[model samples]
Target chain A: TQLLEQSPQFLSIQEGENLTVYCNSSSVFSSLQWYRQEPGEGPVLLVTVVTGGEVKKLKRLTFQFGDARKDSSLHITAAQPGDTGLYLCAGVSLGNQGGKLIFGQGTELSVKP
Target chain B: IAGITQAPTSQILAAGRRMTLRCTQDMRHNAMYWYRQDLGLGLRLIHYSNTAGTTGKGEVPDGYSVSRANTDDFPLTLASAVPSQTSVYFCASKASAGYSYNEQFFGPGTRLTVL
Candidate 1:
């Protein structure tokens, strides 16, 4: 089983602050995805990075895959109340069972205005 | 679009009782998944179905069972509920086109409490 560990289990910051959440694992993965979930709702996918050293940007959010494909990071610029939620990272490998995802512990972020 | 719907949005059951969580998707996704989310454990996969008539065990499948009779529905059953099984359960499905890369659409989730 692959284990992904996320740092800063709980984070609280004022609006407009910048924050970065990290997801690290010892096992190599073919793809990594980031998801944000609000209270009482299922998680929504934010981004998926398939290649090492790949970076994708959506609005003010930037997602980076580690050079070794064993880690990933999510950076939020000028955080807003809307960005507050539980952020999770999931890793997927290649094979017939490739679609299955291994998730991290998740980081809860609180952005207060 | 009613991408996915789960019955009994929330349920409370006594220990040793039987319960089945229903999951249905309208997109006709070929693959469906069941997962449980705990306070500190993020989301753990319980069971998954690649297509109709086929199923596979996930990371935490000891206490859960699933069946897929068709492409649109996948239900999870707990034979004997325990307090340790209490958690928010989520149902998800992905289309065959993006099975390798795209994200899976998720249901609203079912909150289950076992006493």
Candidate 2:
């Protein structure tokens, strides 16, 4: 059984401040995906990182996959009130078929105006 | 495109009752999945269908069953609902046409409570 551990389950930051969320695991993965979910809604994909040590950016968000493929991180720049929501990290195990995904506990970010 | 839609936005039923959650997708994706989201457990896959006439078990499939008789729908069934089964259910679908699988598109989710 593979498990992904996410740090700082809860975060409250003021608008304009930068913050980072981390996801760590001992098992290697073929790909990692970040998702943002607002209240009462299912999660929506933010980014997908497939290579070790690779980084991808989406507007004010940056995502990085660890060299070992066992860790990943999400960094938000100049956070805004609209960014408040739950952030989730999901990893796809190597050689797994049908695109199965393993998810982390999630980070609840509350960006205050 | 109504990417995906789930029936009965919210349901509350007495323990031991049978319940079936309906999920329909419009994208004609080859893969469909069912998951349950708990307060701290994140999303745990209950079942998945790679395509029509094929289904597989996921991490938490102890008390649930799923069927995929066609390409557009996957339904999850609980023979006898238990309180512990109360959680938000999400259905997701993605196309599988190339080497890399696509990110899943999720439905709004259905909230179920068994008392």
Candidate 3:
């Protein structure tokens, strides 16, 4: 079974602080996606990285996919209170059909102003 | 478009009772999925249907069942609820027109508590 392990399960930071969340796995994936979920809401797609060493940016967020396709990372620059939420990384395995995803245990971020 | 909607925003049930969570999508997505979210577990897929009339079991399918009678709805049923089954349930759908990066649109989620 493939599993994605995420680091720093919980983070509490002051406004304008930079933080990075990591997701690692031994199995390779075809693509990786980042999602942000607020309380009582389902996760919303942030970005999708399909190539090895790919980097995608969305405003204050930067997402990187590992060259081996076995890991990924999300970095938040100058995080504010609005950035506080649960971040999740999910991957689509090679040759998998129907867009099935293997999700990592989320990283809960709390940004205080 | 209404996207996806789930019924019974929150529910509380006895341990031995049966429960069904309803999900409907107006986007006409070809693939629909059911996932359960718990603390420290993120979201684990319980079941999925690639299209109407076909369904597949997911990682944590031991205690849940799902059915897709049409293109718009996928409902999940728990035959006998257990305490460990208490979790928030989310329904998601994805279109299969081209090479998909697995961009699934999700519902607001249903909070279920088994007492």
Q: Please report the candidate that would top lDDT against the real structure.
A: 3
For model 1, the superposed segments whose C-alpha errors exceed 4 Å read A94-96
- Ranking under TM-score, best-scoring first? 2, 3, 1
Q: Per-residue error at A18 for model 3, in Å?
A: 0.7
Quote model 1's TM-score for chain B.
0.95
Share of the reference A-B contacts seen in candidate 1? 0.65
- lDDT string for model 3 (B40-73, tens) is 9889999999999999999999989998999999
**Residue clash pairs of candidate 1:** none
* Whole-model Cα lDDT of every candidate shown, in order: 0.91, 0.92, 0.93
TM-score of each: 0.97, 0.97, 0.97
Which residue runs of candidate 3 sit more than 4 Å off their true CA positions? Answer: B97-100
Q: What would the per-residue lDDT of candidate 3 be over residues A1-113, giving only the tens digit for each residue?
A: 88999998999999999999999999999999999999989999999999999999999999999999999999999999999999999998887776799999999999998
Tell me the deviation in Å of residue A67 in model 2. 0.9
For model 2 chain A, give the 10-residue run with minimal summed lDDT.
Answer: A91-100
Docking class of 2: medium
